[model samples]
Each structure stands twice: as structure tokens, then as C-alpha cells.
Target: MATLLLIEDDLMVRATLRQILERAGHVVIEADHGGEGLSKLEQQHIDLMITDIIMPEKEGIETIIEARRRHPQLPIMAISGGGRTRNMDFLEVARQAGADSTMAKPLRAQQLVDEIDQLLRA
Candidate 1:
């Protein structure tokens, strides 16, 4: 079991992810955007983070960068469905920004759980 911070802009996605992580036996802290995620990072002792790329106020890449800077040891997982036009894959950018792992949206539940376990174990 681990404490995970999930930063996502879509309400439905956030709720779904929360359910998934919780079902996997992890405690999840939800954030509507990267700004809120950063604040939560300061307030909570998070074992891992799962963030979306596109968001209001602040983007996941920015969050990843700052989080890495402040908490270099903290593991981060970045997820994205791509840009609205489907031209850009922001997940790569997130990896460059310091995400420990990246997964595309419409993610498979088992893959997510596996990745979380891998990151936490590392």
C-alpha cells in the first residue's frame, strides 16, 4: 500500500483513476490540476504521483519538473491522451521533465497497477 497523488483535470478520469488505485490497495489524494498537486505535495507525504499532461492553471510537465526539483526521490508517473488535435504526445515531454514512467490515456488497469508496483518497489 502507498500514498499516491493523482493530478488530473478531467473529473471523470480522476474519479476512475481514484477507484482503480484504491482497489489496488493504495491511498489516493486527488487534485484537479498541477497547482493543487504541488500544494498537496507540500502538505502530504506522498509515495508516488500520477499526473495528466494537459490541465488548467499548470501542466503536468511543469509539475513533474518542480516535483523533481523539490523531491527528487519521489516517483512520478505521467499520463496523457495526447493534444486536442492528436498531433503531440506530451508523455514524452513529461518523461524528459522527470516523470519516472509514462502511460497513454485509456490506460489498462492492470498495467497501471503493475507500473505502480514497479515504481514503488524501485
Candidate 2:
């Protein structure tokens, strides 16, 4: 099983994602914001990262960029429910920032698991 870092500000959403990932056999490390997520990434061995786009302390796009710079080979999956801005999609921005994959919320558990599995394989 792979160790995953899950960065989400919403407590309920974080709990739900943790449950889903754990059930899928991944060891999940939870962080309420991107800064904490990056701290965890430095402290532990993380195979993949799943981060929400909007967060306090640090947003996902900036986090993705920094994380990518620090760990270029780390797989990142960004999730967002913020929808579109005047011109750009949050998920698309995430990809541009350095996320390996992106998903919109509310996320489907099986699909999430499948995507993580595929990322781990890659």
C-alpha cells in the first residue's frame, strides 16, 4: 500500500477522503492546509498527494508548484469544487501548476481510488 498525503481544509471532506483512501488500502496522512501538507511531505515518505484547490495558509496551485519543485517525481492529484473563475478552471490551473492529475469535487470514491492506483503504477 502507498502512503498518501491528503490536503483539504474542510474537516468533513477530509474525513470522507481519508476513509475512502484507507478503505482502498492507502495509508492517508491528513493536513487541513497546504503548508501542513508540505511539512508532512518533508517528514515522511509519501507516494502520492491529493490536495484541494482552495485553502488557507497556502492554496493548492502554489503548493503544487513548490511541491513539484521540491519533489519532481512525486505524483500529485488536485481536487477542486470552486468551479470556474472569469476565464480559467481551477483544475486546469492545478495541472498547469504541476499536478499530475486533477479531479473535480464532489469526488467519486471508486474513481478516486482508480486514479490513485493508476498514478501509483505510473
Candidate 3:
């Protein structure tokens, strides 16, 4: 199982996602904001990252960019609950910044797992 970092500013989302990942056998480190996420990266052995695009302290794009600088080979999956429209814009920004993949908000746990696996293999 991959050591994953889940970065989301929403309390509910963070809790739910943490539960899902832990249940799936992933070693997960949870962070409620980008700043905390960055700190965790500096302190953990992360294999992949799943981050919410919109966040406090630092946005997902900024986080991804910084992460790329620190660990360019790290795979990142950026997600956002931007309704529908313009959501792609956020995803695109994350991709350009550093994320290897992106997913829409309300992420299906199965899909998240699939993407994480795919990124790890890639």
C-alpha cells in the first residue's frame, strides 16, 4: 500500500477521506490545509498525494508547485468540488503545476484508489 497524504481544508471531507483510505489499507497522513500538508511532506515518507484544489493558507496549485520542487517524481491527484464548470480549469492548473493526475470532487473512493495505483505504477 502506498503512503498517501490527503490534503483538504474541509473538516468533514478530511475525516471521511481519512476513514476511506485507512480502511483501504493505505497509510494516510491527513492535513486540513496546504500549509499543514507541506509540513507533513517534510516529515513523512509519502508515496502519493491527494489534495483539494481550493484550500486555506495555500491553494492546491501552490502546494503542488512546491511539492514538485521538493519531489518532482511524486505523484499527485488534485481534486475540487467546483460544481462542474471551471472545475477543469482548476485541474489543469494542478497538472501544469506538478500533479500527475486530477479528479473531480465528491471523489468515489474506488476511483481514487484506481488513480493512485495508476500513478504509482506510472
Candidate 4:
């Protein structure tokens, strides 16, 4: 089972993802925003990180960059929804920020798990 750190500002999204991942047999650690997520990264033994793009305090792109600075080998999955994004170039932005992969929001359970499996294989 992979140790996953999930960072999402929306409570409903965070809870849903947590349930899905835990049911899939992974250990999940949740953070409410990028800042808290970053702090958790400093303290937790995370195998992979799944983060949302928009959040208070710190953004996912910034979080990814900061995390990559300290943990280059770490795998990151960046996710974003349609409405709240100020920028249109999410995939490109995340790639530039050093994320291993990006997933669009409102994802299927299997899709999320499968992506994590794929990234781990790499």
C-alpha cells in the first residue's frame, strides 16, 4: 500500500478522495491547503502526493515547485477543476512546476488509483 498525501481545499472533494483511496487500500494523509500540505510533506513519510490546483494561502503549482526543490524523486499528481482556475494552461503549468503527472478534477475512483499505479511503476 502506498502512503499518499492528499492536498485539497474543498472539504467535500478532500473527503471523497480520501474515501476512494482508503477503500482502494492505500494509506491516506489529508491536508486542507497547500501550506498545510507543505508542512505535512516536511513531516510525513509520503510515497506519493495528490494535490488540487486552487487553494488558500499557497497554490498547487507553488506547492509542487517547493516540494520538488526538496524532493525531486518524489511523485506528484496535480488536479484542477474547471471553474476556479484563473489560468487556462493547467497541464503545462503543472509540468513546468515539476509534477510527475496531472489529473483533471471530478475523477473516477479507478482512474485515480490507476494513475497512481502508473506513476509508481515509473
Task: Give the runs in model 4 whose Cα sits over 4 Å from its true position.
Answer: 85-88
Q: Per-residue lDDT of 33-115 in model 3, one digit per residue for the tens?
A: 88899999999799998899988788899999998899988888899887336456888888888888888878898987777
Model 1 TM-score, all chains together: 0.97
Please identify model 3 stretches exceeding 4 Å from their true place. Answer: 83-87
TM-score against truth, every candidate: 0.97, 0.95, 0.92, 0.94
What is the full ranking by TM-score, best candidate first?
Answer: 1, 2, 4, 3
Estimate, for each residue in 1-122, the C-alpha lDDT of model 4 and write its tens digit: 98999999999999999999999899999998889998999997998999888778998899999999988999999998844554547857888899999887778889999999999879
Writing each residue's lDDT as its tens digit, candidate 1 over 16-101 gives 99999999999999999999999999998999999999999998889999999999999999999885866346887898899999
Q: What's the CA error at residue 19 for candidate 2, in Å?
A: 0.3
lDDT per residue (tens digit) for residues 11-116 in model 2: 9999999999999998999999999999999999999999999888899999999999999999999999884453338889899999999988889999999999
Model 1 gets an lDDT of 0.93
Cα shift from native, residue 8, model 4 (Å): 0.2
Q: Which 10-residue window in model 3 sums to the lowest lDDT?
A: 82-91
Higher lDDT: candidate 2 or 4?
A: 2
Cα shift from native, residue 52, model 2 (Å): 0.4
- lDDT agreement with native, every candidate: 0.93, 0.93, 0.87, 0.88
